[model samples]
Target: MSAAFDLEAIRRDFPALDQQVHGRDLVYLDNAATTQKPRAVIDAVRNFYERDCSNVHRGVHALSQRATVAYESSRTTIRKHIGAHDSREIVFTRSTTEAINLVAASFLRPRLQPGDEILISEMEHHSNIVPWQLLRESTGAVLRIIPISDEGNIDLDAYQGLLGPKTRLVGIVHVSNALGTVNPIKEMIAMAHEKDIPVLVDGAQAISHLDVDVVDLDCDFYAFSAHKVYGPSGIGALYGKRKHLLEMPPFQGGGDMILSVRFEETIFNEPPHRFEAGTPNIEGALGMATALEYIDGVGLEAIRKHEERLMKEASLRLPEVPGLRLIGQARQRAGAISFVLNGIHPHDVGTILDQEGVAVRAGHHCAQPVMQRYGLSATVRASFGLYNREEDIDALIRGLESVREVFA
Candidate 1:
């Protein structure tokens, strides 16, 4: 009903939104986990398989050439999506986990010395935390955490203190998946640069909701997943500075990653090819490009405004429910909200919500450190996307009311 955006028209593009569950209209609020694909993205994947299915950068035939163009074109699209300087800076990976691991292994591990430090925030996902732990085990480097306040914002002063002469790299999430806290990445990156430390931003939860510019942020490394942005699974991208990608070693070695091979020595191809080993996810890349195009059509500024309105409405209404406690009250946030009901397990709340045809996520959200910080085992989460509307929030509220009635 808002003049700036037509919610119904936007909803029509996503076929999955027009469905029923348990004889009631489906209300999907699990977008922080993975987004439902738009029809354009789905058709792009199907078209690739139906007409242009072939291995990229290897075949000489028409299908192969077509597939190669589509695949590589997606890389270019993604490069522009994040405002990287060149397409070669974008390396395709299976997920954000792989991208971060690539940077941790090839970029940071070799450079680290005993007693060197890698700084991360308290709100990082396990993907951001565990890789550094593995690197620390191998190289004897120390991992230092930047403490977060009770409201879930990273303590800026604490973060500055964590940066010292021994600090080599900083890995932080641009947005908290569980708490929806949007970190001050630009400021944080500048702060780290003051100590000449490189920073890698985990943008998995941010790319879909915000207008991300790697050039503007001047981050050393940035990563995000396609599925989190209404694209297909099994494909994502890591955007590194040209200087870093050229210097870093390959994460995986296989066909297409090398210029030539022999018994003596294999000449490695330049990145992003060096990082993309084996047959790349050609279909996935094309589908992801279509998804980005879909987002572009909607306009990120419009999406941000719409989601902000929804967040404000939910913040006002959800608290009115008896015994429901909203967690992570950060002044700046997006995409999701985590909460708990007194005496009710999160799984129980999720199950009850499902009976009323409201889909949500229930668990630690792969951020157990965050749960530990809050002194809880798990919390129920409701995340948003472009297709979401006020009706979805209303449905979630009514479902919670039903849960309260049952518990009473």
Candidate 2:
């Protein structure tokens, strides 16, 4: 552990990490799915419901005023966290999936012409892939995939070659969920920009594990989920460049996304608010901001170093397990690692590990194209979070041994 990273103290911040499961101390390694929330975030959510519960932007009462202030304050915090220029660039959505969908429907759909291209990678989560597919089906556009290498690295040469005149937008994942590949998105974004193409990054897996600066990357849009970063679920944010957000139309129609409405024509609101249609997740935003503050309090650089160390340890030890085959040999990896055990179904591996109080994900991890590339239906994924420890990796290895014994 780094000198600044006090593992024991950090673990204590997450109340969920203190419990036992299946008669053993729980070892949670499924951070790619969602992370365990710290106490500060939980209290933020609870406090909102307990005291500051009220509708925002529509009421003048004290509770509503307080709620509204805290809610919008979160948007500012998120903007700062990602190094976005303005809070108006931050639009809240249900999750990363919805954020992408909003971009597809409101931003790209208007500009897309028949036979125009939307570029993405083979390692994308379904959230990144399906929206573009839906756009293609509806608009007669073409969806192009940037192939990944055998080692799970995106082929940059291929990516550069595909940025042709017909390409409308580039949607990429900063950190792959299944493979743990940390893509060179900054370079990729620059390549797309050379051709005057805008790029949208699926940052769901990157927000907690990496230092994301939207301005530094110059990406047109970035989307991430709160739950994956130890915040509440059902709330996420989309960071769009101010120009794009100003140009895009409203995604949904309801309470907050408009300035005025008439039966003939409804006048829409400005960017961010224009895309955010409905009452919004009031407490969720507060909790999400609190979660980001918690990360800041702990120091993101130290957390990064700690996770990298744990990942290196896991890399060294996991291959020692009998019949284990580590997946995705990308030179740069983040909080996720995947592998398969010979002749054993990944679901079975997950079940056996669960019995030993080891939690892991066993599936294609919403990246079916990645599995298809490797000729696999599924693989066992062990992901890390800021709260994870060296002992967790040991427990996972011991649990894999038990799996081997049972199968034998």
Candidate 3:
């Protein structure tokens, strides 16, 4: 542990980590899927329900005003968290999938011509891949994939070669969810910029673990989910360049997104408001902001150091297990670690670990291309979080022993 890393105190802030399952203390290693919410986030959600349960942007009542302030204030917090140029660039969405889809539908779909290209990496989640595929089917646009090395890192030289005049945009994952491979996004974005191509970063897996500055990175767009960052599910945000957001049409047409409506014609509102249609997730916005604040209080640098230690320990120890082969041996990694035990299916490994109170993810993790790259269908993934400790890794190893015994 790093100096002054009060692991116990950090663990206590998350109530879910204190509980047990199958009569053993829960060692949650499924953080890459969704992190357990901290008390601050939970409390913020509860307080909203108890006090300010009103729709924002429509109501004239006190509750509505309070909800509106809190909701929009959360947007400001998100804007600051990502270092976006303006709050107007941050549009709330259902999740990262919706955020990416928004860009696909509003920004790119109409502009892309037949035979135009959309480039993404082999390690992208389905959310990033499917939208481009759908765009291809609809508009006759071509979708190209940048292959990854055997170690799961995106091939920069290959990516540069693939960038051409017809390439409309590049969508890259900031971090690999299944492999924990952290892509050098800043460099990649710069390369795309040289070709005058916009880049969209799938930041769902990177936001909680890394220090993200959209301004510094100069990415055209960034998509991420609150659930992955210790906040509520069903809410996420997209940070688009102000220029792009202004040029793009609204993804959805509904109440707040319109400035005026008549039977004959309708006029739309400005950027963020235009993108966000209907009643927004008021409580969710508040909760996500609180989660961001909690992370700030803990200090991202400290959290980074702590998780680095855990990753190093897991790297050294997982290889010790019999017939186990770690996957995604990238040049750089963070968050999740995946491996397969010989003669054991990943599902079986995950199931047996669950019996010993170790919660992990199994299967393709929504990255079938990554699975295809390795010529495998699935692998077991143990992901980490701020609340996790080295003891959790020890417990995970011990649980694997149980899995081995069961199969034997």
The TM-scores of all predictions, comma-separated, are 0.98, 0.99, 0.98
Model 1 misplaced regions, further than 4 Å: 1-4
Model 1: per-residue Cα lDDT over 1-408, one tens digit each: 224677898899999989999988999999999999999999999999899998999789999999999999999999998898799999999999999999998999889999999999889999999999999999999999999999989999989888999999999999999999999999999999988999999999999999999999999999999999999999999999999999988888889999999989999999989999899888999999999988988899999999999999999999999899998999899999999999889999999999999999999999999999999999999999998999999999999998888888
Give the alpha carbon lDDT tens digit for every residue of 1-408 in model 3: 234768898888899988889999999999999999989999999999999999999889999999999999999999988888699999999999999999999999989999999999999999999999999999999999999999989999999999999999999999999899999999999999999999999999999999899999999999999999999999999999999999999899899999999989999999899999999988999989999888888888898988999999999999999989999999889899999999999999998899899999999999998999998999999999988888999999999998889988
Which candidate tops lDDT?
Answer: 2
Better of 2 and 3 by lDDT: 2
User: Per-residue alpha-carbon lDDT of model 2 for 258-373, expressed as tens digits?
Assistant: 99989998899998888888899999999999999889888889889999999999999999998899999898999999999999999999999999999999999999988999
Q: Which ten contiguous residues of candidate 3 have the minimum total lDDT? A: 1-10
- Model 2 off-target regions past 4 Å? 1-3
Supply candidate 1's per-residue lDDT for 247: 98
Model 2 worst lDDT window (10 residues): 1-10
What is the full ranking by lDDT, best candidate first? 2, 1, 3
